[model samples]
Target: MALRLEIFDLQLFIHIVEVSSLTQGASRSAISPAAASTRIKNMESTVGARLLNRTPQGVTLTSAGRSLLSHARQVIQQMDHLAFDMCDFRGGLRGQVKVLAHTTSLTEFLPQALSGFLAAHQDVEIELQEALSDDVIRAVSSNEVDIGVVSTPVTTGALWARPFGRNRLVVVLPSQSEFVQLPSITFADTLTAPYVGLSAESALNRFMARVATQLGGEYRPRVQVSTFEAMCRMVEANVGIGIAPISSVERYVKSMNIRYIGLADSWAIREHILVTQHLEALPVLVRNLAQHLADYAQTHLPGPVELSYGNP
Candidate 1:
């Protein structure tokens, strides 16, 4: 009879080899050191060979163990893939899709998109994470997430980016603020207002700086905030005027007493993109989701918005 192998046992063995200490491996596997030792012994008994060499410093894999380690890892990975594939087959559109997006997309775009998607296909479960635009691209490139929605340009050579929509950089002010009545204002006028800027590290911040310079205004902001939502809140509280993507403003519009005005400058357009790594064989659900997003983009973002790739 073939020996019954446990997935946990295989995971424990791999962890032991990687960590080079039974204590460390046990800690990682959430198993007691004694239990870990017994499991290794059982594995050796079944295989009929010693798998590790113990020294004062640490444990090293034996020749036999070294030979088996690679195969063991491959087997574990294949098993994981098999489980996902089985779930996909059984659930059909109900299978989970992991997605990563920036805060703006998460707050503004995904809520509507996911609602429509779920309404159409009740079986699909989406696992969405909000991250920075750069982090979103990295997640998609590594296949950690099935899709990434970001404001920044795509950088991964192995991934494909499709233009999803354009977001306008609108100047947000308190409802009672004097700037609310401005027909159209230049970037200089915006900079002159008490500005609550997004983080200096953000792509929006860089774009704002470039536009400010073009309009011959110094890009010195009075308050620096970490998130677009926070910036809008600050603006609503009369802390200072803020410039952010219109989508972000739309997200907090109901709760905040702020008015968003479009900048007259042409440089205020920010394009949003959807990115995915090239799949050898695309999954049916993923293909359907991609098509749905493409159709939505075409329908909503009717006019051309300026697009920049891999820019600060």
Candidate 2:
């Protein structure tokens, strides 16, 4: 009789090979190192071959281990596909979509788009998190997240993508401030008047700092907050001015006692995109949601939004 390998055993082997650490691989699956070693030994004995060579540096995959690695990946992929198909058959539309998006997209356009999608597909659940443009690309490429909404002109690296929306940067100033009357403001001029900024870690804030550096100045914001709403509120209190997305602060201008002015700089305008591993390979529910977002953005997002596909 042929030796039968359990799914867990195969998974353990794959993890060990990928991490190059037996202890780490075991820990990942919540198995003891001793038990994992025993299982690997049994598997080797059953196969009548050495799968890995132990050394001081760590284990190296033998020829047999390399062969099994490819097979393991394919089998896992197929199993995932099977699971997705099974869930679809059991229900018309129900699955979880993990999504990562940049700060601007999260604060601005994605809420409405996702809300519409949720309304249409009541059974599906969305797990959304904020990430920078680069991290978003990396997450989607590694299959760590189901979908990603990222800033445009970024390299997506073999992932299928389409234009999701556009974001325009605006200066948020107190209603009674002198800058409120300016038609458009430049970065240098805005900084001179004192600024209330987002957290230092935010991509937009980093870009703003870079702009200041180019102008031979430093960004020393009077205050820095985590969210756009918070920044707007601070500006309204006359704490200082702020740079925020128009979509984020559009509804808050009158209520929050803040006025927004468009930035004259080119970086003020940004294009965001929807990215996935492959459109055709996506589960039905996930695909539908992605399509819905794309459609919503097409009709709702304002001008100068580039809704095109590009290679990473």
Candidate 3:
């Protein structure tokens, strides 16, 4: 008959090798030291070899024990992987997904994708919030949100992140504006121009304001509207020009008499990232949604991205 192995025995042995103390390993395994000794003895008897030498200070592994230590570690590691890997095969889906996204992602891409996700996942509830990039990252890091969509990729310690999409900033102008005649307009040149802005509470508005101030200019909005479409409307009315992501204003480009000018600024280019804690830790429904979002990004956007930040 083949000797049956107990996982706890292997774990106890590995921990003993790690700490050099049978008592400490037994404590970690939640077994009494006497019971641990019996288990080790039984394990040794089954293997037909003495495994360790008990000492006054601590325990030292015998040559046989040293030989088996590497195998024990491999077995424990594989068991841990198995516990997590079995979850991958389960097809269970149901949970709430609290999502926080920055302004560009909230306004441009996530709506359609989220709608599709909602349609597919009837049992899953989604609570979405609009926040700035930094705030979204913080929320995910702090476990306040299940997922975050950010316009710019940043260091997310202990979090898994993937590229979601792009949000290239563009200038919305009336057809007759002289600046619109140019292929692209500089931020400094547009700072002096009449601007239709979003609410002051909006991150994009704050970003533009900060940029203008940094360039030794002020953002004087002719009118402040809540939505990108409203900003485009105000621009179409020749009230003021607006700065928005091309994705946000694409629908209005053909129907509305407006010009989409690229912003000649490095910051104009923005990459969107989906960030969250470990995907395996999330509920089945949430994990599925995350995978769908990643898949969508791969197919629709540039490509798939998997970032495993090794350090916390």
Best by lDDT: 2
Would you give me the overall lDDT of model 1?
0.73
Worst window of 10 by summed lDDT in candidate 1: 303-312
Stretch of 10 with least lDDT, candidate 3: 303-312
* Clash count, one per candidate: 2, 2, 0
* TM-score to native of every candidate shown: 0.59, 0.73, 0.65
- Taking the tens digit of each residue's C-alpha lDDT, what string does model 1 give over 226-266? 88889988987899888777666767877888886677766
Instruction: Using TM-score as the measure, name the better of candidate 2 and candidate 3.
Output: 2
lDDT of 3 by residue, 1-312 (tens): 786668889989988877889899999899899999999999999988999988998989899998777667656644544543455466434456778987887877788778888886565678888887888888777555678988754667788888888767888888888876577778898877888999988878887887788898898687999999999999989998999887767778778988877788877888889988788776555567888888888787643222121111
> Between 2 and 3, whose lDDT is larger?
2
Most accurate candidate by TM-score: 2
lDDT of 3 at 55: 92
What range of 10 consecutive residues in model 2 has the weakest lDDT sum?
A: 303-312
lDDT pick, better of 1 and 3:
3
Model 2 RMSD vs true structure = 6.8
